[model samples]
Target: MFNMILRVTENPVRRTTARDIAIIAVFAAITAALGLLPAIYLPVSPVPITAQTFGVILAGAVVGGRRAGASQLLFLALVALGLPLLAGGRGGIGVFVSPTVGFLIAFPTVAGLIGWATERVGAPYRLLPGLVVNTAFGIGVMYLFGWVGMMATTHLAPWAAIVALAPFLIGDALKVVIATLTAKGVHASYPGLLRSRTARAVAGAA
Candidate 1:
């Protein structure tokens, strides 16, 4: 019975080891820490510029889709639980109803999508394609959600929403560039950065 239990527990193909859970937790903590960075608030927009995007991109690039999404979910859970883990050290149930809430809720999806796109770039980690994917999908999608949320919450016209969100575009684009370069450097230094366990399993079989 003990042997059978060990086999069940240690079945690498069927389960994540404690190490994986711990690593995911660490990434979640990293995401939370990034949110603690100083925020620059725009007078016209409820969204504040923060380093959280950098963490979001890095988490996805390093952890792949499922784990990256898990990490983001964990971070959001912390915020939902009333931890001051959001930008400007703000958190709690109140944030859920705030204008920026849609963007907050979309974090996991954005990370997962970014991870999926980055994985398709294959080996050697070509910089440009990954950069473009991260920019177009990661930051762009986030802004879309945020803009809609702002309009909905503020009852602003589309043009007003666009004007309010415009200030963030250039800064966010710079963040995407930074995240892309960072991901490229990590991939070059650690060639296994983007490899999923499923890929490893298939490769080992072949």
Candidate 2:
């Protein structure tokens, strides 16, 4: 049962290795560092454009589903513990009640979803599918949760959240593309960064 929980896909013994743990920690730090970038706030929107999501997207692509989720959860746990790792240096328990709370809560889910998508789509392919997959799950599901959070916290109508999110569409698309390309490149160059299903099976056999 524990193995089932830890399996990246079908193989259970993939690695509770130091290497896997290191990748998770490094990616968590990467997300925090990216969050330190100055956010670009549009006059009309409450959420700002920040680089943290770039790390969020890449974490899944590079680390696979389980490790990616761990990295994101670790980042969130630190923020909740007053690490000041969020965008604009805000942190602690108060963050869960903010207007942007939905996005904050959904961060781990986003990384997991992206990693799951990457695992299924299979890498080293033509990237258009990855772009589509990332955009669908990453941008689409992300905002859906964010929109729900906005309405819940801000007491706004559904249309208000939908309307406000309009400014972010283009930039997020670009992010999806960048994340897909970068992840694929990393996979091609260093296949061991994450073991594909085939790769894992082969390793297990030998």
Clashes of each: 0, 0
Candidate 2 regions exceeding 4 Å error are: 1-15, 40-47, 196-206
**Per-model TM-score versus the true fold:** 0.79, 0.79
Residue 191 shift from truth in candidate 2, angstroms: 2.4
Badly placed stretches (over 4 Å) of model 1 are 1-15, 39-48, 196-206
What is the per-residue lDDT of model 1 for residues 107-187, given as tens digits with 9 covering 90 to 100?
888888887777766655667887887887678888888888888888999899888778777668777888888887887
Q: Roughly what TM-score does model 1 have, to 2 decimal places? A: 0.79
After TM-score superposition, what is the CA distance of residue 88 in candidate 2 from its true location, in Å?
1.8
| Deviation from native of the Cα of residue 149 in model 2, angstroms | 0.8
Q: Give the per-residue lDDT digits (tens) of candidate 2, residues 1-206.
A: 96885575564545577677788888999999988989877665565778777888888777778889899999998888999998789899999998878887777888998888777766443378777777887898888888999999999988888887777776677678888888778778877655346875677679
